[model samples]
Target: MSKIRKKKIKKTNILLGFICVLLAILLGFILVTSYKSEQKESRHLSEIADDQQSGIEDYEAVKERAKELEEISSEEAEDTEDIKSKNTEDTEKTDTAETEDADKTEDTKDTKDETAAAASGIVCWGDDLINGEESNTYSYMAVLQKLLTDNGYNMTVINKTLQGGGTLSMMKMAGVSDETIQGYITRHQQAANGAQLNVTETGIRDLTEEQTTRNDMDCIPVIFMGYYGGWNHDPAELADQQEQILNTFQNKNQFIVVGTRPMDGSVTSEALDQVLSQKWGEHYISLADVTAQPSSTYEAQQAMAEAILQKLQELNYISKN
Candidate 1:
């Protein structure tokens, strides 16, 4: 081989070696850059995964907090309901106590009024027909009470008539045992203690010694009719018995006779009226003359009671308003 050719070959080999080394160095740089880029991407992905995990934990905490808030709300609601129920019970008890107090106060006022009235003069009435069961429209005693009250008089009217008997029975009752008569008056007072106007069916027999002495009885207006239990009584005998009863009173001037028309056609009302008028004179009052017949009827009884009240006022037996 020639020396020049050998030298040129040697130079070419050296150049080629240098070129390979440069290519290898470039490849290494490229590989290192690619690995660094991959590591950066992995770090970004890890950061994103950490953020997601944190979000999940926050969501769990929020859910737990919501559950706690709900439990608090439920407990508060139960407490509110219990408070409302207790308030309602207390209000009801207060209302009941108030009503009881009001009733007691009213009862006391009524008793006081009754006591004051009982001390004053009391008007008395008697007769089977007048003291009978009250009718739908008007009771004779009730009518009399209203008239007297309208005239500024507070009076308690008491009926002293036997259930089935007439004037004879009234006389007998007047002569009863003093203890028995006193007991009846006591019962009547007890029953009337709280009433505005007491109209009792206890007959004149209830007029005991205690009543006459303790209370000022101004007048006893008697309504006596002959007819009773579908039979007519003798007017003369009935008047005699009535007079006997009136004599028992401490003040005979308090007796006022009133005659009623017979319900039956067998007996004339004028017959009894004449007998009463002859005995009692100006003190006698005829129901038929004052109003109409059938004093048992509501309208007729009302008119008769009014007329009797007027007569009592005219005669000055009761104080005028």
Candidate 2:
């Protein structure tokens, strides 16, 4: 064939080969750039995953620390409560012990004072006015004993009064008369079984030797007899009876006599009260304006006891401490 035609064909073939080579190089460059970009995205995702894991771990660690703090606080609170409770218990125990000690001390002092009272005493005598006629709980002698001891007097009281309204009967109980208890009982029976003499039988019997346990040196005598002391209501007769009763005790001068108006103040009762007040002086408690019935009441007995307590206080029979 022609030489020029063959040369032109070869040039075309070379140009096509060069174009194919250029296209292959461009495709390789694009593939390599895509692969590098994919690798960079994977590295970024890995870094983000690592950061999230660290954050989760930090949150768990913080929760554990908070739980530890809560446990420590609970233990501290329990310890504080225990200490407070122990302190309160100790205080209560100390207070109770102190109160008990005070009570024991008071009891000891009272026992000592009571022992002193047992040695020295006061003896009382009257009709139903001072006896167990109303109620032994309201007995002036019993009440007086309590009052004396309460006021630090420490004085015991003995009652020799008759429940029945008979001055001779009371004198017999006081061992100031020779009248027998059986005789009194028999007389009571004759008077429609008047009163019980047996209740005060321990007071006396046939007794000059009965005075061995008691004497004027340790005892004081008190008397109030008006209801049936004498049917005639004579002041001289009452005075004679008073002398006899006073003589029964060894200390006749240190006796207390309470005189009250009988029959609502006849001249006899006034004269008797005046005579007793003059004779006994400071030892006499006069109730000349008070009626016999009023003097026999329980309230009157309490008043009489209060007056006796006053006189005893004036005589300095009680302790100040």
Candidate 3:
């Protein structure tokens, strides 16, 4: 209880206080470093997503094409509703007897329209793209079919896009074996190979043509399977998965690849498209150049379909004549 003992106790307290302050400073530094690391990771993911939302270019061409197709569609609808416009125009000039004859002629035309010959069927397999979710307010495939038929080509499109399905379901629909389908998922997952944003595990696969028909050899398989790959996946990996899928086809000449743009509007795969072009030249198609709208619209769908039709003709799937 003397002065020396009291002084020793006070010095001990000071040393303990210093050690506590040093530990607190170290802890604070560690916490800040950890927080910054997490934030950087978050920013990286957000940056990747932001990047996908870019690449929407050449929008005026899409708008112009849409304007033309919409006008044609309007005229076609009027013709369908006013099939006997000539007779109506001449009704006031003719008597009741002449009108009766005209009615008979109109009846024949209606019958002919109702019993038109069956069209050559083209098969399309896709995901959300089928629903106009890709860039329009309606099924772009419908417009694609119309573009063919309205131009004197005898063709009908058969869409096999499942309403709420994914790639796995698409493969299953195509009669891919369970083992093969599983391999597809595995192949894609391996290709994805990222921290947590791999997309194949999140969505679906696609379909084919030869498997759907027993005797219809003319059916051409058109496939669009890039949504899962382009959504949150690395573009190179997406290209890899697409290459793997194409290799799975027994006869590469029998199918067409409708290249996909991610929902966020980025290009699906420039390298893959190049690879496809180098191999089969024009067997590949993409709507990215045809559209640059930030959102879907009827016009965009029509324009995209028109673009596809032009490509089909270029590729000799449809006769130029």
Best by lDDT: 2
- lDDT-best of 1 and 2: 2
Worst 10 residues of 3 by lDDT: 111-120
Inter-residue clash pairs, candidate 1: 160-203, 160-204, 161-203
Lowest lDDT 10-mer window, candidate 2?
198-207
The predictions' CA RMSDs to the true structure, in order, are 19.9, 18.5, 44.2
**For residues 212-255, what per-residue lDDT tens digits would candidate 3 score against the true structure?**
43332345556766564432344454444444444444333545
For residue 276, give model 1's deviation from the true position in Å.
Answer: 1.4
Cα lDDT listed for each candidate: 0.61, 0.64, 0.59
TM-scores for all predictions: 0.46, 0.46, 0.46
Candidate 3 ranges with C-alpha deviation above 4 Å: 1-120, 128-137, 187-218, 230-254, 264-280
Worst 10 residues of 1 by lDDT: 196-205
TM-score of 3: 0.46
Q: Compose the digit string of candidate 1's lDDT tens values, residues 236-317.
A: 6557656766666555655467776444453577887788789888778787787765766677778777877777655555
Q: State the number of backbone clashes in model 2.
A: 0
lDDT, candidate 2, 1-321, per-residue tens: 699999999999999999999999999999999999999999999999999999999999999999999999999998898898889888988998998999997876665445334335777766535443445667677678878777666566776565554555555545553554455444434554454433232233333444333354346777777665342345655666677677766445456777876643545655777777777777778754433437667777777788878776554334444
Tell me the lDDT of candidate 3. Answer: 0.59
- Number of backbone collisions per candidate: 3, 0, 5
